[model samples]
Target: MSDTGLHPGLVRPRPQRRRARSRTYSATVRTLGPLALLVLWWAASATGLLTPDVLASPAEVLRAIGELWGNGQLPDALTTSLTRSALGLLIGLAAGLVLGITTGFTRLGDELLDSSIQTLRTIPFLSLVPLFMVWFGINETAKILLIAVATTFPMYVSTSSGVRSTDPELIEAMRSFGMGRLALVREVVLPGALPSLLAGLRLSMTLSVIALIAAEEINATAGIGYLMSQAQSYARTDILAVCILVYGLLGLTADVVVRLLERLLMPWRTPQGATR
Candidate 1:
């Protein structure tokens, strides 16, 4: 043996090797699994095992994509979808983060908001859509409101619970050190709550995207959701499938952005997972 003791380079190399191995496995599994499914789907459609009336083949969807692309409808619809979803998500994140922190940190706030939140959470998300429409009209306001409301609760619950579950010993130590209220929150509580808050935010974003799509689909003049709805009227399943694919892609893109942000915001989080 060249060296019995662990060298500085050797110590780090083990972890680097393990990480690379893990990534290789993860990538292979994810890609191969999806590829297998796609092959099956393509085969089934080609063999007429699946009805084209109900399920468009990938080729058909691609052809429809070309048409949509040529018409310049795809870009316009995508822009509208992104804009509405982003706006709604921004509003919801702000409201939910503030409320969640206040309620989680204070007894008085918990007493005031808990019961109301509990009751409201039980109501179906879809049920609120019509109410939003009536209250705000069938305009961008209604769509945005619908998405924002859908996004709020998940974030509130996650952030509040994360705060509540923070290690009391750490909190006590901070208090013993004479940390002020704002500093305690800014330095301790918020950071402790961040992992959970991120989880809630991720959920909210996915939900908001869905809610916005529903809002647009029900009645709207623009957006991918509108295109999907319009296609259904004409029995254009290929275009409908294309819209669904776009929704999936957009959702994936949004989640990836959030994951990157989480990594930046919580560098302390290990590869193992978020602590909470």
Candidate 2:
């Protein structure tokens, strides 16, 4: 038999070719799945399979978005929501980082706070709505605090886990160099924990967005959630869909931002499944 025909079915591509194919497959699915779903949604809406009052069509949503923009309602709602989320996120991040570091690095701190935090994190943050409403009054403070509360646990947990998982040998080496508490953490611990911190940030931000929506929906008069509530009252599914999509896009944007930050801060870290 000729060499080319002897084992044609047995030929395997090179490793590079395999990786390229894997990446291509991953990208294709990520793109195509959303596109396919969009097409299906459009088809269903057009065929009346999805009732307008229940699920607005993409075109209706677009029109609603345009109308909101023209009337400046969307911009005001967006600003209000973003302001609340931003304030809450900053406060949550600061508290979580401080608490995480204290408990992560000190037995005394851990003994004093870790158990309580772990226990508290078990309860759904949303369950605090009634209590918050009573204490904070259905004001922006309550909504912002709700977002802060929802976001804190993820960051704290991830940071603690990351700190605990740092290499013992590396830590010992740092200690041998007469590294003080501040230097040790600044130089070694924080860098080691960057991945987990960023991961937690992503989760926390996403949760904050969700909590903001819930908080606003309950008693808001000037945010995206309030707009959504009004839309519901008016039976405007298109406006509701627009708000939902905006929330999704904001979450997606946050995730992408965190991923970019991770790449920027951890240049030495290996990309998953890529050859060094």
TM-score of every model versus the real structure: 0.85, 0.88
In model 1, which regions exceed 4 Å deviation?
A: 1-22, 172-178, 268-276
Q: What is the Å distance of residue 151 in model 2 from its true position?
A: 0.7
lDDT tens per residue, model 1, 151-180: 888888998899899888998899999998
State the TM-score for model 1.
0.85
List of clashing residue pairs for candidate 1: none
Q: Which 10-residue window of candidate 2 scores lowest in summed lDDT?
A: 12-21
Q: For residues 1-276, write the lDDT of model 2, one tens digit per residue.
A: 447665555764556443334556666766897799899999999999999978999999999999999999999999999999999998888888888988998889999999999999999988999999999998889999989999999999999888888898998999998999899889999988988999889999999889888888667889899899899899999999999998998898898888778779987775575532
